[model samples]
Each structure stands twice: as structure tokens, then as C-alpha cells.
Target: MRLSRYFLPVTKETPADAQIVSHKLMLRAGLVRQTAAGIYAWLPLGLKVLTRIEQIVREEQDRAGAIELLMPTIQSADLWRQSGRYDAYGPEMLRILDRHQREMLYGPTNEEMITLLFKDGARSYRDLPRTLYHIQWKFRDEVRPRFGVMRGREFLMKDAYSFDLDEEGLKQSYEAMFVAYLRTFARMGLQAVPVRAPTGPIGGNLSHEFHILADTGESALFYDAAIDEVTREELLSADASTITRLTDLYAMEEEEHAKVETCPVPAERLRTRRGIEVGHIFAFGTKYSASMGLSVQTKEGGQVHPHMGSYGIGVSRLMGAIIEASHDENGIIWPESVAPFQVGLINMRADDAGCAEAADRLYERLREAGIETLYDDRDERGGAKFATMDVIGLPWQLIVGPKGLEKGVVELKNRATGEREELSVESALARLVG
Candidate 1:
């Protein structure tokens, strides 16, 4: 994508309304624009990052044997009434009325709706163990929505529903989702720790919230420092024997902490830090299924309520949370996995014939190699172009100038590491394309 032809409306001055680092950087980088108090219109760059994150989440869910399906943004209120949550859900539910005066809602979650769907078609235990997921937008009317997308009124969410025949079967479904969440965050270059959390309105005795530690995070979390070094491969890449071994690690929220005298590590090894909740999993046995009449016939020819679980990942909130965890003082240093573009080609002398020729050739070479390259073909000052490229935070930057064009050399700089090297045009192209 050529920068001159792109719609990247970057700003040098920080907007006064943005209070947090991610919020401010998002605006300055031209990733998003506020259309309302908490609602935002994701610009081209922001949509690219959001799509990448969604793909990662989808792949991980597929690997865990979860089937994908899309659900609608609007739902009938009759389903919520069947589950006895019509009035219990409170004002955040965003209740509405159609022209016919029928009650409807922009679903905040899909527990009741999914339950009704399951009850209608699934009749026998043969379809007992099924995991269904959808990536869709959700609306929750927060009275005071703030923190950019982190606490927005409307956002994208990846919610999965699992069904099982019995308590033992439910455990397997829960474990699968637990492993899936770990793999999802790991693929995004984030270390998310699973901590026991209150079910809240979701209503489940067993729940876990995956949090990524950041200074600007909303929740204060406590965990063993050993969790920081534990990888998803360490937990999920082993046999059933190893599952017990990895699950023994001490990790929980402050509410679940015990005051036992014996400690696994030492008091010093315990780390309490602020973190943002990225994903949550809950196993609510017979809660919605029973109320909604979602029953399946067992081997004994008896009808029983199917145990269920719901898993959620705040898809849009992750965009902000990732920026919070990854950005530097200058701008966002995007991980290669979620970067909008792999390289930024800055034509230091866009008006100069030699510099333009060199940059154009490099840009074509990078694109032909299947790299996402953004060529700055604008006739802007060298310093301004470089600063904008840095603030945009492309993984690599290639500079073409008149002096370098004469020597058949270009400057390559790594965004993560502040290392700059002058190399032949061929070498620079190889570094970027290879």
C-alpha cells in the first residue's frame, strides 16, 4: 500500500480527551476515530490489526475442536424471559422495542438464545459434547463508557458455548476451552495468566479470567511469578499424566487467595500486578439449559438438562490491551503477528528521480515477495516522513535518499531494536522480503 494513496490520517498532537496510553497512541497513529462517547469507527489501519487478532483467535479455537458459526447482533427478548434473566440483566442489556411494539435487545451475551437453539434441535445425548462459537458485535449500555475500546459501549466479542451430557463430560469441555484461550493469547505475543474470577451476572461457580499484565490495566491481579515463564506448550503439549503436573501451579485471584502458612515458592516470589481481562471461561451447570428446557435423553431413556459452559474473549478490547502492553514512548511497537504492515518504505527524496526510482523498485520487490509493504511516496520532509513511520510502528523501515541511491545502498532500521545498518539495495530488500 502506498502511503500517499492510503487513508492514514496520522496526527502529531495528542488529543486531550485520550487519557490512557493506548487511547492516545491509537488516535495519534490514525488507527481509530471516535464517532460517539465510547463508540469508534475503526479506520483502515485499526481494522487490519483487528482482523489479524480475530484470525488468531479463530485458528486457536479450531485447533481445540470448536466449530464456528455466526450469530445475529439483535435477539428476541422471549429467550431471555425463558431463562429468567429478562429483568435480572439490568440496564446494560439495552432493551428496545420494534415498530410493532415487540420487545427486543442487542444481545450482550448469548446464553439464553443459544440455550433455546440447543433445546429445539438437539434431542439425544449423541450430540451431547459440542462446542459452538461465533465472532460478532455486542452492545452493552454502560452509563459511563470510557477507556477507548477497552471499556466501550459496543464491541466485538468471540463467544463460545459448550454442551455436555454430564458433570464429567463438562470437565473435558472446560479443559478444552482453557487450553484454547492459552494458545490464542500466546499466538498474539501475550502472556495471559488464568485466574479464578467471580462469575458475576454470568452465574457459574467455576470461572477463570485470563489477564495480561499492564500498568494501565483495569483489574488488580495476584499470581505466582512462575506463571510468567509458563508457556501454552508447557501446559497443553503433553499427555494426560502431564496435565495434572502443570495444573498444580498456584494461580488465583485475590478473592480466592488462602492464608495457609505453607507456601509453594516464597512470599517474595508472589507477584501482584494490574492486568486487563482478555478472556473468560465459565461452567454453569444446568443454569440456562434447565430454565430454557434444553434437555437431552440419556441411555436410561430419561430426560436431563445438559451441562453448559460459555467462553468469551473481548475482541475489540484486545486491540487496546495489546497496545497497552506493547507500545513504547514514541508509538506502538506492534508484534509481527498483528502488525498492519510488515515494512514501511520511506522515500527520503520522493521528488528526486534517482531516490524515487530506487524506492519504487524496492517497494515492488517487497510486494512481489508477498510482504505487506507501505511505501511513503509523498513529497514530505525527510524528518517528517521518518517520524511518521516510527509513530506508525511498522516492524522495519527502509530509507532511500539521493546519496544512498548513488551508492546503490539503502538504510534499514529495525523497529523493535533501535539498530540501523546501511546495506546494498539488494541486501536491504532481502532483509525485508526474506
Candidate 2:
């Protein structure tokens, strides 16, 4: 992608309405724009990052044995009524009426819709265990939505529903998702800690929220420091017992922490930190199935309500969370996995025919090598171009200037480390492509 042809509307001045670091940075970097209060239109650059994050979530869900299917943004209010939550959901539900005077709503969640779908489609015990997921937009009428996408009223979410015949089966599904969440966040260069959290609104007896530690996070966590030691290898090999091993260590949100009669961890081992909640999983036995008449036949010729669990990852909010966890004073330092473009090819002297030609050739080479590179071919000053590259936070910046090109080399700079070294054109290609 060439910057001259791109639609990035970057700015040097921060908006007064933007309060948080992620919100301010997102605006200044031209990643998103506010169309309405608590709502944003994801610009091209922002959409690329969001798509990358969504794909990671999808891949991990598939690896965990969950099937994918898309659901609609608008749902019949009758579905919520069937689950006994139409009114109970409160003002955030965004109730509406169609021309026929029938009730409708922009779904905040899909528990009711998914439960009914499974009940209508699957009849026998043969379909006893199934986990279905979808990535779509959902809206909630928040009274005050701030922090950019972090608390947006309209956002993208990956919510999965698991149906099982028995309590034991639900536990297995929950643990599988638990492990998948760990792997998903780790792949995006985040260390998310699972902490026991209240079900609230979703209504489940057992629930856990995965949070990424950051000073600007909304949730305060009190946990055993050892919880942070769980590694990617362990998560990959994890089973049902993985839940026991991690949750057994003391970890709780502030509300849960305050209710503890006695602290489990010794003084030194207890760690308190602020974390942004990115994912949540719930095992609510028979909550939706029983109410919505979703039951499977038993071998004994009996009908029993299927146990259900819901897992959610804030697909859009994650962008803000990542920025919160991984940005510096310069701008967002995107992880390679979720970066919009892996390399920012800056033509420091675009007006110089030699520099422009070399930069264009390098961009083509990077693209041919299956690398995603953004070529800044705009007629701009070197300092301004460098600042823009840093603001967008591509993993690497390939600098092409007459002086460097004349020396038979180009400068390669690491965005995160600010390490710059002159390398032969071929060497630069090999390093980035590798």
C-alpha cells in the first residue's frame, strides 16, 4: 500500500474529548474516527489490525474444536423474551419496533438466538456436545461510553456458545476455551491472566475473565504472582486440569478480593495489578437450554436440558487493550502478528528520482516475498515521513535516501528498539523476508 494513495488522516493535535492513552493515540495515528458518541468508524489501517486480531481468535477457536458460523447483528426481540431477559436486560438493550409493530433489537449478545437455533436443529443425543462461534458487531446503549473502542457502544465481538448434555461435558468445553484464550492472547504478544469474575447479566455460576495487565486498565486484580508463570507450551498441552491448576492459585477481581475471609497467598506472593478485560468464559448449566426448551434425548428414552456455556472475546476492544499494554511515547508499537503492515518503506527523498526508484523496487521485492509493506511514496520531508512511520508503528522501517542509496545500501530501523543499521539491499530484503 502506498501512503500517497492511502486514506490515513493523521493529526498532531490530540482531541480534547479523548481521555485515555489508547483513545488519543488511535485518533492521532489515524486508525479510527468517531462517527458518534461511543461509536467509531474503523479506517482502513484500523480495519487491517482488527482483521488480523479477529483471525487469531478464529484460528485458536478452531484449534480448540469450536466450529465457526456467523450470526446476524439484528435479532428478533422474541428470542430474548423466550429466554426471560427482554426486559431484564435494561436500557442497554436498545429496544426497537419494526414497521409491523413487531419488536426488534440490535443484539447485545446471542445466547437466546443460539440456544433456540440449536434446539430447533438438533434433536437426539448424537449432537450432545457442540461449540459454535461467530464474529459480528453488537451494540449496547451505554450511558457513558469512553476510552475509544475500549468501551464503545458498537463493537465487534467473537462469542461462542457450547452445548453439552451434562455438567461434566460443560466443564470440558469451558476448560478447552480457557486454554484457547491463553494461546490466542499470547500469539498477539499479550500476557493475559485468567481471574475468577462475577457472571453478571450473562448469569452463570462459574465464570472467568482474561485480563491483560496494564497501568491504565479498568479492572483491579489481586492475584498470586505465580499465575503469571504459566507458559505458552503449558497452555498448548493443557486439558481440563489446566483450569484447576491456574484457578487454584489465588486470583480475583477487586470485588471478589474484598470478600475473602482469609487471604490464600502469603504477603509477598500476593500481587496487585490493573488489567484490561479482553475475554470472558461462562459455564451456566441449563440457563438458556432449560428456559428456551432446548433438550436432548437420553439413551434411557428421557429428555434432559443441555448444559450451556458462552465465551466472549472483545474483538474491537482488544485494539485499545493492545495499545494500552504495548504503546510508548512515540506511538503504538504493534506486535508483528497484529501489525497492519510488517514494514513501512519510507522514501526519505521521494523527490529524488534515485531514491524513489530504489524505494519502489524494494517495496515490490518485499511484496513479492509475501511480506506486507506500506510504501511512503508521498512527496514529504524526511523528518515528517520518519515521524509518520513511527506513529503507525510498523515493526520495521526501510529508509531510502540518496546518501544511503549512493553507498550501495539502505538503512533498516527496528521500530521497537530504534536500532538502525546500513545493510546491502539484498541483505535488507533477506532480513525482513526471513
Candidate 3:
């Protein structure tokens, strides 16, 4: 993308209402714009990051054998009524009345709708186990939504539903998502710890919340450092035994941990930190199925309700969470896997035809080499371009200046490390492409 043509409306002044670093930085970087009290319009840059995060979540879900299917944003209120939750869900569910006076709602979750689908589609035991997922926009009308996308009223999410014939099958399905969530967060360069959590409105005895530790996070957490040692690949290949290892660890959110009278782990191993909630998994066996009368004929010729589970990863919220977890004073330091663009190509002398020609050639070569590069070809001052590139925080930056062009050298910068080196243009391209 060329800065001259791009729609990045960056600002020098920070908004007074942006309380957190991520919220302020997002505005300054031109990632998002506040359209309402708790809603935002994702600009081009923000959309790119959101798209990349959603794709990573999809790949991890697919790897765990969960099938993808999109659901509607507006749901029939009758669906909630069928599950006996219409009145119980409260104001968070944006209930509405259609033109014909039919009760409707912008869905906050899809547990009831998914149950109805499973009930109608799987009438026999042959379709015993299945995991279905969807990535869509969800709305929860918070009375006081704050902190930008971190607590937005309208946001994107990946929600998956698992159906199983028996308790054992449900456990297996939950385990698959449990591990998949770990890998998903880790791939985006986050260290998330899974802590036992209350089922809340979902109504399940088994639930876990994945929290990524950050100083400015909302959730106060108590956990062991061992949770950080596991790798993404290890979790990707995890199994039943992996569950045993994970469950044995002592970890909980501050609210739950504070209620405990005694601690199991040694005092030396205890650590307390604040973290952002990025993902959640629940195994609510028969919660929706039994309430909705979703049943299938057993092999023994008996009708039985299928066990159920639901997994969710906050897709849009992750953009804010990642920024919270990884950034410096300059701006966002995006992880390579989730970065919108891998390289930022700057034309230090955009007005100089010779420098512009060199930059143009380099941008083409970088794009041709399969690198996602953002070219700053605007006729602006060097400092302005540098500031924009720094704020966007692409992993690597190549600066083409008139002075360096005379020496047949361009400067390559490491955004994360703030290291710069003048090297031959050929050398810079080789280092990035190869």
C-alpha cells in the first residue's frame, strides 16, 4: 500500500477518553475510529490486522477438526425462548422488535441456535460427534463499554460448538479445543495461561478462560510460570495426557484464587499478574441440548440428549490485547505472524525523482518476492515518513534516501530492536526475501 493513496488518518493528539496504551496507540496509528460510545469502524490497517487474526484462529480450529459455518448476526428471539434463556439473558442481549412485532435480538452467543440445528440435522446416533465453528460479528450491550476494541459493544469473534453422543466424547472434543486455543494464542506471540473459570450464564461445571498477561490488563491473575514453557507446536500435537499435565497445574483468576483459604503450590512458585482475556472454553454437557429437547436415537433404541461444549476466541479484542502485550513508547510492535505488513518501504526523498525511482523499483521487487510491503511514496519530509512507519510498526523497514542512493546503500531497520544498518540495496533485499 502506498501512503500517498492509503487512507491512514493518523493524528498527533491523543483522545482524552482513551485510557489504555493500546486504545491511544490504535487511534494515533490510524487503525480504528470511534463511531459510537463503544463501537468502532475498523479502518483499512485495522481490518488487515483483524483479518490476519481471524485467519489464524480459523487455521487452528481446522487443525483441531472443527468444521466452519457462519451464523447470522440477528437471531430470532424464539430461539432463546426455546432454550429457556430469553428472560434470563438480561440486557446484554440487545432484544428488538421487528416491524411485524416479532421479538428479535442481535445475538450475543449462538448456543441455542446451534442446539436447534444439531437437533434437526442429527436424528440418529451415526452423527455422534461433531464440532462446528463460525467467525462473525457479535453484540453485547454493555452499560459502560470502554477501552476501545478491548471492551467494544460490537466486535468480531470465533465461536465453535461441539456435539457428542456421550460424556466421554464431549470430553475429547473439549480437550481438542483446549489445546487448540493454547496454540492459537502462542502463534500470535502471546503467553496465555488457562485458568479455571465460572460457567456463568452458559451453565456448565467445566470452563476455562485463557488470559494473556499484560500490565494494563483487566483481569487480575494468579498462576505458575510453568504455563509459559509450553510451545505452540506442543499444544498442536497435544492429547489426553496433555490434559492431565495441564490440569495438574495450579492457576486461577484473582477472584477465584482469593476465595481459596489455602494454596497447593509452594509459596516460591506463586506469581500474581494482570492479564487480558483472549479466549474461553466451556464443556456444558446437556445444558442446551436438554433444555431445547435436542435428542438423537441411541444405538440401543433409546432417545438421549447429546452432550455439548462451546469455545470462543475474541477475534477483534485480540488486536487490542496483542498491542497491550507487545508495544513500546514509539508504537505497536506487531508480531510477524499477525503483522498487517511484513516490511515498511520508505522513500526518504519522495520529491526527488532519482530517489523515487529507486524506491519504486525496490517496492516492486519486494512485492514480487512475496513480501507484504507498505511503500511510503508520499511527497513528505523524511521525519514524517519515519514517524508513520514507526507508529505502524511493521517488523522490518527499508529506507531509500538520496544521500544513501549516492553511496549505493539503503538503510534497513529492525522495528522491534530499533537497530539500523546501511547496506547495499541488493543486500537488504536478500536479507528480507531470503
Worst 10 residues of 3 by lDDT: 228-237
Q: Summarize candidate 3's per-residue lDDT along 1-434 as a digit string, tens digits.
A: 78788899988788899999999999999999999988999999999999999999999999999999888999998889988899999988999899999999999999998888777799888998999999999999999999999999999999999999999999999999998887788789888888889999988899999898899999888877676676666775667676677778888888888898998877888888999999999999998999899999999999999999999999999999999998998899999989999999999887799999999999999988899999999888889888888888899999999999999999999999999999998899899987
Error of 1 at 390 (Å): 1.5
TM-score of the candidate numbered 2?
0.98
Worst 10 residues of 2 by lDDT: 232-241
For 133-171, candidate 1 gives per-residue lDDT tens digits of 999999999999988999899999999999999889888
lDDT of each: 0.86, 0.92, 0.91
True-structure Cα RMSD, model 1: 2.0
Clashing residue pairs in candidate 3 (N, C-alpha, C atoms within 3 angstroms): none
- Tell me each candidate's TM-score: 0.95, 0.98, 0.97
Candidate 3 positional error at 197, Å: 0.4
- State the lDDT of candidate 2 residue by residue for 372-434, as single tens digits: 999999998888898898888899999988998778999999999999999999999999988
